[model samples]
Target: MHPQQQLALALLAYAAQRGLAVDRLARQSGLDTAALLSPTHGPLSAKQWHDLWLNAAQLARDPTFGLHFGEAATPAALGVVGQLVQSSRTVGEALTHGAALLPLLTDQVWLDLAHSPQSVWLRFRQLPTELAASATVVDHLVDFVLAFVLHELDGLLLERLQPRTVRFPPGARQLPEHLRVLRAATLAAGPPGEYSVELAGACWSMPLLTADYELQAALLQKITQWQAARPAVEPLRDKIAGYLLANAYLGIPSLEELAANFSTSARSLQRKLQAEGTNYQEVADAVRKSLALHYLKMGAYPIKEISYLMGYNELSAFSRAFKRWTGHSPAHYQPASASRSLPG
Candidate 1:
C-alpha cells in the first residue's frame, strides 16, 4: 500500500490553493507538513494516504477538492507513472499502460479497466475493505482519473473532452459543475463496489500530442530494475492480515481459499499461523474488530449498516460479536474508550 509522495502533496497543494489551514490539517492527519513539502519523501501506507484525503477535505470544507486537484495534475504532480502515460502513443495505449503502471503507484488499491462496445470503463476500488469507510475519497478517485485521462488526450480532440458517463459507489457525493467546466458528463450512483469512469471509443483511440518511445523505454527499464530487487518473501502474518482486511467485507475467506491464494495448502497455512502465534479465526476476528471500532468511532453509519459492512447478515449477530470482542454492544461502544483491540 505504499503510495508515492506526490499523492499526498496533491491534496496539500489543493488545500493551499483554497487557502485552508495547512498546519491544522497536517496536525489532524498526524502528517508533518514541513517534511511533506520537501521534494524528497517516501511512500505512504494505505491508511496514511486515506488520512491525507480525509483530512484535506474535512479541513478545506471542499468536498470537490479532488476534482480540482485532479484537473490540475501534471506529469510532475503524479510522478513517473503520469510521465510514462504522457509518453504513450495514443490515449488507448495510455489506458493499457496505466493499468500496468498503477501497481507502481500503490499496492493497496486496484485499478481495473474493462472494455465495452463503444467505451472503456475505468474502475477503481480500494483493496482493503477497511479503507472504504469514507465514500468521499471515492469521489476524489473518480474525478482524479477522469481529469487525468482528459489531460493526456486533450490536444487530440478538437474540443475539451469528458467521460461519457461516471459511476460511483452508493455513498459518494457528486458535483456536476466540476465536470461541466470541461464538458457535459453524466454522473450517477450505482453499486457500492468501485468508482468508475466511462470513456467513449473515439476518445480512447485518439493520438496523444506527446508520444515518445525512447523515453518510455528508459522509464520501463528503471521500473523493471526496481521490481527485480523486491523482498523475496513477505511475513506470513502480514500477508494474512492484509488478505483478511481486504476481504472482510465480502466475508473472511475460508482457510482453504486463503491458503490457495498464497499457493499453499490449508493445513500448511494453519501451521504457519500457529508458528506466528495466532490462528485464522483470531486473525479474521481481529480484522473485523479493527474495522468495527473505526466505524463506531467515526460515527458515520448506523449500527445496522456497520454490521452489514462487517459481513454480518443480522445486527444481532454483530452486536453479540462486539459484546464478546469488547464486553459491550454497539450502542455502548460509542464511547471511543470502549473500543478494544486484538493483535492484527
Candidate 2:
C-alpha cells in the first residue's frame, strides 16, 4: 500500500534536525524533495518507504533511529488521522477511531485492540503486502509504530501512561537504553513475528484532554467522503505481491498455491495476471528482487543469509538471480563503510 506523503516528510524533517543530509538521503531513496513538499505529491509505495528508512538509518549510523524518530514525532505529523484521533472522547474511542481510519495514513498495517478482563492490548499487524521483509526494515518500522503509539497515548492522558507489558517481536535488537521511552513496563519478546503493548483496563476509558465532539464529527465526515471515493479493489499484481511478502518465511508459494489462495484455478489466475501484462514468475521475481536489494543495501547481513532469506536453497542460484536483476553482483551494492559484522 502507498503511505501518505506526510509520513515521509516527517521523517525527512527529523533527519534534518539530527544534522543528517536530507538531500543525499532523498536522492538515495529515489525521492524528489521538491515533489514531496508540494501539495500535489502522491503517496509513496511500500518499497519507497522501506528504502527511505534504510537510507535514514545508514546516514544516522544509528540502528535505533526509528525509535528516536517516533519518540519525537507528534500527532500533527500524521496529518488528518492524527487530528481525528486527538479529538476522540476517550482513549478507547481514540484508539478505535484511529484503527478505523488508519488506511488514510497507510494500509501497510492495521491497528487492532484486543480485550481481556483486566487489560487492553494494542496490536499493530502488517498487511500481507507490506514489503518490509528485511530484519533491519522490520525493526525500524515496528519500533517507530510502537513508540509513536505510546507517545500519542501519553499526550492524550497528560501523564506518562506506562503499559503493563511491552512486547517486541522475537529477534528484535533494541537495547535497554533504547527502550527507556517505554518507562517501567515489563519488556519481553512476544511471538516470533508480532508487536504489541498491553495496557491496564483502567486506562481504556480515560478521557482524552483533546477531545472535541464537534471537531471529531467534522473530520469524520471529511474522511468518510475521501474513503468513499477510493477504489474498492486492489490490482491483481499487488494482491499477489502482498501474499508473497506476508508468507515469505514459509517459502515462496507456487503458482497453484497462489491461485488457490485467491479461490481460482491456476489457469484462470495466469490469464488474469497476463491480462494485467505480467505473469506469476514476473511478480514473484519482483518481490524477491525488492527484498534482496533492501537487505543488501543495509550492509548488515552476509550474502549467504540474504540468499536464504530470499528462499534460495543454493547461494549460486541467488547470485545468478541478483546478477540478472541488477547489472552488478550483490557485493557491489553493499556499502564499504558498513561493518561486515552484525550488531549486538
Candidate 3:
C-alpha cells in the first residue's frame, strides 16, 4: 500500500500555493516534512495519503478544492508519468502509457481504457481499503483524478477534449455546477461510487501536440531500466521485517495487526510466512535485533532507554535478548565518548 511520493509532494505544493498551512497539513497527515523532501525516502503509506487529502479538504473548506487543485496540475508536477505522457505520439498512446505507468504513481488506484464502436472510455478506480472507504476522501480524490486526466488530455491535444459524456459517483449528481470544467459534455451519475469519462472513438487517434519519438524512446528505456533494477514483488518476510523495523520505536504491531495491514487473515499470513521459511516471531526478533545492535553501536542512548525504544517490557528482558544475540551485555557495545543521558 505504498504510493509514490511525487503526487503527495505536488499536493503539498498546491496546498502551500493556496495559502494553506502546509506544515500543519503535513503534521495532521502524519507525514514528516524532512522525509517528504528527501529523495531517498520511501513512498508514503495509503493511510498517510488519505489523511493528507482529508486534512486538505478540511483546511480548504471548499467543495471545489480538489477540482481546482487537479485542474492546475502541471506535467512537471506529475514526475516521469507526466513526461512520458507528454512525449507520446497520440491521445490513445499517451493515455495507454499513463495507464501502464499508473502503478508507478500509486498502486491504490488504476486507470482503465475501454472501447466501444463510437467512444473510448477512461475509467478511474480505487482499490478498496479501510482508509479508502471514506466518502469525503473518495469524492475529492475522484474529482482530482478526473480533472487531472481531462486537463492532461486537453494539454496533449492542444485542444479541449469535449468528452461526449462524463460520469461521476452518484454523490455528484446534485453538484453539476461545481464541474464546469466538463460543461461541454453530458453529465450523468454512474454507479454509486464509480467515475469515468467518455470521449469520441476518433479521439484516440488524435496526435499529441508535444509528441517526440526520440524522447519517448529514451524515457521508455529509462523506465525499463529502472523496473529491471527492482524486484517485481518483494518477499513477504522482507516486507514484514521492514515494517517492523520502521515502526519499532512506536511499539511493534501484533501478528493480527500486521496481517490486517498486509490485507490478509492471520492464518493466511502465517501460512505465507511459513512458506518463506520464517514466522512472525522470527521476523519481529530479527528486526528488534538489527535495531538493537544499530542503536547500541551508535551509543546515542543508554541501554535502558534503548530497551524501551525496542519495545521491551523490562530492561532484564532486553538484556537477556542482547546476551543471546551478541554473547555479551548491551553495555559492551557502548563507545567511550557516548553520552549516558537519554534522548529528549
lDDT winner: 2
Q: What digit string (tens of lDDT, one per residue) describes model 1 on residues 1-344?
A: 12368767766755654446778877777788778767666776567776777777667665665665555454555677776776777777888888887766655457887776688878887666545535666566556666656643553232356777777677666665455533546777867877777777676677765422332333334334434554545467655765455333234556765554444568998998899898888887887787677656654446775676566788888888988999877776565443342211
Q: State residue 67's C-alpha deviation in candidate 1, in Å.
A: 1.3
Task: Tally clashes: model 1.
Answer: 0
Candidate 3, residue 42: the lDDT equals 70
Model 2 C-alpha lDDT versus the unseen true structure: 0.71
lDDT at residue 186 of model 1 (Cα atoms) = 76
lDDT of 3 by residue, 1-344 (tens): 12368788878877754547899999999999878878877778878877888898788775656665666565655678887877788888888988898777655666799876698998887676655546677667767767777766754553566777778766654464344655435777887656788888998888876532332333334334434554546678876765554333334567875664444578999998999888998888777777667767766667776686566768888888878877888878777678773321
Per model, how many backbone clashes are there? 0, 1, 0
| Model 3 weakest 10-residue run by lDDT | 211-220
Each model's TM-score? 0.54, 0.58, 0.58
Q: Which ten residues in a row have the lowest lDDT in candidate 1?
A: 211-220
Residue 147's lDDT in candidate 1: 64
Q: Could you give me the TM-score of model 1 versus the true structure?
A: 0.54
Write candidate 2's Cα lDDT for 1-344 as tens digits. 12368878988977865557899999999999998988778888777777898999888887777776666566656777777777788888888887787777655666789776699898766666637446687677767777777766764564567888877777777576344656636888888667788888887788976432332333334334434554546678876775565434334667875664444679999999999999999999997887677667766667876676576878888888989998778888888876762221
